[model samples]
Target chain A: DAGITQSPRYKITETGRQVTLMCHQTWSHSYMFWYRQDLGHGLRLIYYSAAADITDKGEVPDGYVVSRSKTENFPLTLESATRSQTSVYFCASSESFHSYNEQFFGPGTRLTVL
Target chain B: AQTVTQSQPEMSVQEAETVTLSCTYDTSESDYYLFWYKQPPSRQMILVIRQEAYKQQNATENRFSVNFQKAAKSFSLKISDSQLGDAAMYFCAYRRRVNTNAGKSTFGDGTTLTVKP
Candidate 1:
């Protein structure tokens, strides 16, 4: 596919275990984001990157870590997964931060922490 | 900080009928964007429509349209001639125009739409 993609469509992890979710995009977009979708919260951004090696925290970024060493890749890691971290993770990218450019989202990764 | 709110948790529409999902947002930035995303059972987030804050004309895409009230801080999505494929979770989101902060979107809780044939 030419759009963004997330690996491990579904994942199962234990509490206190470390897990990393990988995101890749073929568009070479300038901005990429990581968000988690829960039942009542919709999608909350965990982190976002402006370009390679430039990342920033979002609304919920306490236990999560993200790095963008390349424009085509942005991986989010959970140092110590918790039960509350169980949710659907989505990766998105855009050509720029401008309002005119819409963000393209991936199929999402369903992560379950037991 | 920006916050998006979708008040209706669930909605139902009969085939060929129309349904509107309401969304409201709070933001201090004057120039920004509003978007409606549809997530079907497949869990892929698809952009349904988008509206720029500065544009006076509403945005429409096929059977999907939006009523953007900038002064009221509201953006609602309307789906006409509803089809079974239209049944999905609809989310409203807000984003800024500038690239200084990466333009992260703030999403609403989402409205689940059910189309009855």
Candidate 2:
């Protein structure tokens, strides 16, 4: 597909285990972001990258790690998953930070940590 | 720090009727942007409409419109002639206008809209 997509639309993991969620976009957007959607919390950014090899933390980045070695790919990893970390993960990309640039989001990855 | 709040957790409206979702934000910056996003069961975040802070007039997209009150820091969405397809989670978001802080969006908890026939 020409749009953004998330791998493993659904995932299940145990506490303390390591898991990674993948995101890919065909738009070659300069900015890529990872966000988690939980009940009562619409969506909070976890990490974002401006370009290849550059990433920054977001509101809920305490236990998450991200890498952007390519403009088309941005993957988020959980070093030690916890039940608190279980939520729907979404990946988004925008052409630029300009006000006219609207973000395009992937379908989302629902992760369950038991 | 900027924060967006959607007071209504869930709401329902009969088809062909109208419904409004309220959103309030706290920010010190003068120039910024407010947006409404819709997410259906498919979980795809779609931009419903957006309003620029500098503009005095509100923003509208077809059946969707926003009531942006900059002084009051309020941005509410009004949907007219609601349809069954309108049932979804609607989120209000804010973003700074500056390039340095523009890529990140601060989102509200979201308002779930249920449409009945």
Top candidate on DockQ is 2
**What is the DockQ score, from 0 to 1, of model 1?**
0.73
TM-score of 2: 0.98
User: DockQ numbers for every candidate?
Assistant: 0.73, 0.76
CA lDDT of every candidate:
0.91, 0.93
User: What's the CA error at residue B108 for candidate 1, in Å?
Assistant: 0.4
Residue-wise C-alpha lDDT for candidate 1, range B1-117, written one tens digit per residue: 998989999999999999999999999989988999899999988989998899999999999999999999999999999999999999998988776765578889999999999
Docking class of predicted structure 1: medium
Tens digit of per-residue lDDT, candidate 1, span A1-114: 898999989999999999999999999999999999996668998999989998899899999999988899999999999999999999999898775687889999999999
Weakest 10 consecutive residues, lDDT, candidate 2 chain A?
A96-105
lDDT for model 1 comes to: 0.91
TM-score of each: 0.96, 0.98
- Chain A TM-score of candidate 2 vs. true chain A: 0.96
- Tens-place lDDT digits, model 2, residues A1-114: 799999999999999999999999999899999999986678999998888998988888999999988899999999999999989999999998685579999999999999
Per-residue lDDT over B1-117 for candidate 2, one digit per residue giving the tens place of the 0 to 100 score: 999999999999999999999999999999999999999988899999999999999999999999999999999999999999999999999998998765688999999999999
Fraction of native contacts under 8 Å reproduced by each candidate: 0.77, 0.73
